[model samples]
Target chain A: MTNKECQWGGEERGILIVLSGPSGVGKGTVCSALRSMSKDLVYSVSATTRLPREGEIDGVNYFFKTREQFLSMIDNEELLEWAEYVGNYYGTPKAFVEQTLASGKDIILEIEVQGALKVKEKFPEGVFIFLLPPSIDELQNRITNRGTESEETIRKRMTAAVEEISLSEHYDYIIVNDKVEAACNRIRSIMVAEHCKKERYLPKIKKWIEEVL
Target chain B: MTNKECQWGGEERGILIVLSGPSGVGKGTVCSALRSMSKDLVYSVSATTRLPREGEIDGVNYFFKTREQFLSMIDNEELLEWAEYVGNYYGTPKAFVEQTLASGKDIILEIEVQGALKVKEKFPEGVFIFLLPPSIDELQNRITNRGTESEETIRKRMTAAVEEISLSEHYDYIIVNDKVEAACNRIRSIMVAEHCKKERYLPKIKKWIEEVL
Candidate 1:
């Protein structure tokens, strides 16, 4: 048996899981529960050109950097996926994710549709899971209950959601967040199953077979 | 929400899970546990031309078949995969497995490596999971403990195991049968995760999107 605490067949590399869905789908709640559920699971902390807000630690909250450094990373192809959001470059740092996975920890990336698709281009084997609200009515209700958005803003979000769902087919799996705990469990199950995937154990298994023979 | 008793993303067609490994790798134990673990799971009863031994139930033990009927099934391509074993044709019934799946029940097929691979060629979408022992030595120990096997038979199986492990990379997932219960849980998790696969929901999701839009 390999040193992995998870009892998979071979020495398994940590899986990269990209989770994407529309707003008001309760992704945050389910991801938080997942973090508590598995100690081996890590949330990918993105690097940003924007300054960290109050009480935000450098690496823990976000890897805050100047515009020059952030742009430098993009030029070096160090970011898995990056985009300008409100004039600040926010992106998943490739090094951070690689280092975390190298340490035998599975990383879950909660990102938007574009970013998730971009990550797929970079890491084609990554598991892409799309989270969906139970129903459109429930999704609208959840958005409205937020009370922070104007009706116009809510309508804009709903429109965006429809477009987001249209792309859900590109994902490897779709998780309906009808219940928070159930959704978290489903993600965890996906993680475990991914570990058993043939791609992860190919090299090690080939070597093991030769040695055993 | 779909009629699936299991809460997956969409109405899932029952998946045909083909489980195969070396003879003494404890697939029987894991699969038996799985049958009890999920009531929705059904074991695929193979059709064999060999006469049913004393006290053997026709449909329950094996679909006891005459050589003529089995030959006709082969001609009609009714058997998904078949093999001539000791002058008797043993095979999986395509109709039975399809009907079981169409009725929204997962069917587990415990077959040899050749049969499993054959089934994969026929049903490319079926989940092919390779059950493996922790190591070659442990596998020998297991076969030895079986007392029913002669030393030569055990040695033959051990040699066969090396080839099987080499081919395990062809499987969708590999389950290490370290602990029976743990292996069972891994299979169950794989089943749940497979249900959430996007390919299973593509057509339904498109229709759902059109309706919602």
Candidate 2:
């Protein structure tokens, strides 16, 4: 409990850590590893118009929605960020993330680069982390190893990956996915370090210094 | 090692981490613990006109200097930050810190707040961390526990500590010294997280994307 006070000041809302990168850069794997490593982090499940895959439960894997419902959420500004890809709509529902953070629990959002950028527009305070492959060859190898894409689709993905990487300067931190465990550790470090930032805890610190002396 | 590129980009200078806070905030203890845990961080030895204490070695504990020698170093601007304390001149020698960082090894400098502010003027890129006691009463307790200071000296230290803590808003991060091991771990997290900062590696990442990809 002593360390808890030191971990973060009392009564502050938790941080939103946005994990994004080019497709196939292992964002999901790293985020899952990070969450497994630390119980303090809550994953922000997204909503999608796309049909659920086998065994994917609604609200657990994603908030499966109809296209009309997803569009309505977007129109009402109830979604933090949304994008259409390959003929299906995907978005982050704002209410759950807001409620979780207000309760002082940190949340991790693993999303596409475009969705991450949109979230940054609305929540500038969010910690935007850009994941990266060890190299282009490695990224290509990852996509190839998945064995789901055609040669033409692979080329398109590589080109899109390059474009996404170019926008990395817009992120707060970069984690190259050289190894899953190492990338996860770096993310944990980033989370701890963000908690220590003066901007987040200075008011509480100042109050403690001024009042309780 | 693959992780080396991920640790830091090629050929960039290492960071300088400045650890400073109030007089009795346990900055030194936490820093020493940090060094013991991390082999990569080199501790910076300061220069002083004050005579060396028992078992203190020249260039190890401090670069012991006469008033004349200290004044000359000040005249030549060889010291990064110098202050007169208890009628003695104390300073951080500029050369060693610069050389260590330039050679791509981080250096930790634990010093008074005044001296740290001076170092900030010279090395703006350095990571400035302010250590804090859990509370003012805790800080007073730490000073009292030292047993070397008289009542009047303790009062003076408490006043100075307050003034120093008020300036903490200028720091990049803050670590409350509730527990020494926890504080050390937080400092280590700051170091690791600083490497992940986009500002530190954006150019390298951009170049990699453009050229190597």
Candidate 3:
């Protein structure tokens, strides 16, 4: 079939990209780089009841809300996925994600391994990506260099990192964050490759075949 | 778990890679490039009953077998997949593929869509890749430019090309052969990424978690 004859119909499926990594592997940096490269991608702003930290903006970093509103969402099952953490509620709203996807924009969700599994359950088509540090020493160095946590916390976080790394098996793809550009390129390539899958292009292929034949 | 402590186990599932494209799309060229980059890859040699065209080596280009052997294989279901074209039989041996993968080598099976789909049915975990020319015009130009086929044969081949392209949607990945090096890089990256999938790494991950915790 001729490529020109193939007509793309309706809204393309919104790709659900789940990014998870060790705390210091720079997943946020890779995600930001990806966002800068493609404006069509929407970073899914998670909903939370945690008080906005200093300089954090409402609806920008998160949809910060009252405990009542958060509980109400949970009650109505409006959130695609949610989790209670450190006595505060954090969740992904269904409406915004659906709206963003319907408009043909890809959504990127940076969440932990556990949260990612929950999101995957709700959206089975979501693409799961696990980011890894080059080595344990590198991961330790990065965590220590951050200076946000004490020695005890660092050890605890490292233990948690190991647990998270174990869940790496559940992810669809794993990117060892040896270099930001290289990792971002892999992610971008995966996105491009996914779009070319048979399920996505069969209709167009069929139409093109009929025209050329 | 540390890389030193992590043991490669029997749980690693085999990856089935299917390579297909229009004639002269350089599928063989790309496959050769891929093999050069990874020495552990096992290239599946087809079992065929065709007389060896000049310079064709038995068990290299194909497993040259007699009609009786080929028919017996088909009857005994020893072939993973097979197809008859004109007066020759071509099939992939099931035992060789299973043995190659069990030894941890990535298997690359260069087959047509019919054979590919049949193998996929038996091994649903297979990765299917379709190679395409940069454009339809370029494809037609390449086919005609070869001067090997007459006008009538070219027309028949073009129709067949359209049919094959229509089935491209069944593939997991579609690579446009615009540039050889770039296509090779993407294909290699895909193989690396596939190896890092959670399904392949989960056992190691589970062990790592146990060690750390």
- The best candidate in terms of DockQ: 2
Candidate 2 chain A minimal-lDDT segment of 10 residues: A1-10
Pairs of residues clashing in candidate 2: none
lDDT of 2 at A41: 89
> Can you write out model 1's per-residue Cα lDDT over B78-168, one digit (the tens) per residue?
9999999789889999999999888877899998787899999899989999988876678879878878888788778778877877888
Tens digits of lDDT, candidate 1, A51-78: 8898999998899999999989999999
Q: B1-213, model 2: which lDDT tens digit per residue?
A: 113555336336788999999887888788888899988889999999999899999999999999999999999999999999899999999999999988888899998898899999988889999988887678889888988789999888888787888889888988888888988888888888887788876777677766745
- Output the number of the lDDT-best candidate: 2
- Put down candidate 3 lDDT per residue, A1-213, tens digits, no spaces: 111112333126667788987677898899999899878789999999999999999878999989999999999988989999899999999888888877777799988788888888888888899888866788889988888788899998888787778777777877767778777877876665555555666665577677776
lDDT of 3 at B112: 74
Any idea what lDDT model 1 has?
0.83
Error of 1 at A31 (Å): 1.0
- Superposed on all Cα atoms, the candidates' RMSDs to the truth, in angstroms, are 2.7, 2.7, 5.3
Candidate 3 TM-score to native: 0.72
**Any runs in candidate 1 off by more than 4 Å, and if so which?**
A1-9, A148-151, B1-9, B148-153
- How well does candidate 1 match the true structure in TM-score terms? 0.92
Chain A TM-score compared with the true chain A, each model in order: 0.91, 0.87, 0.86
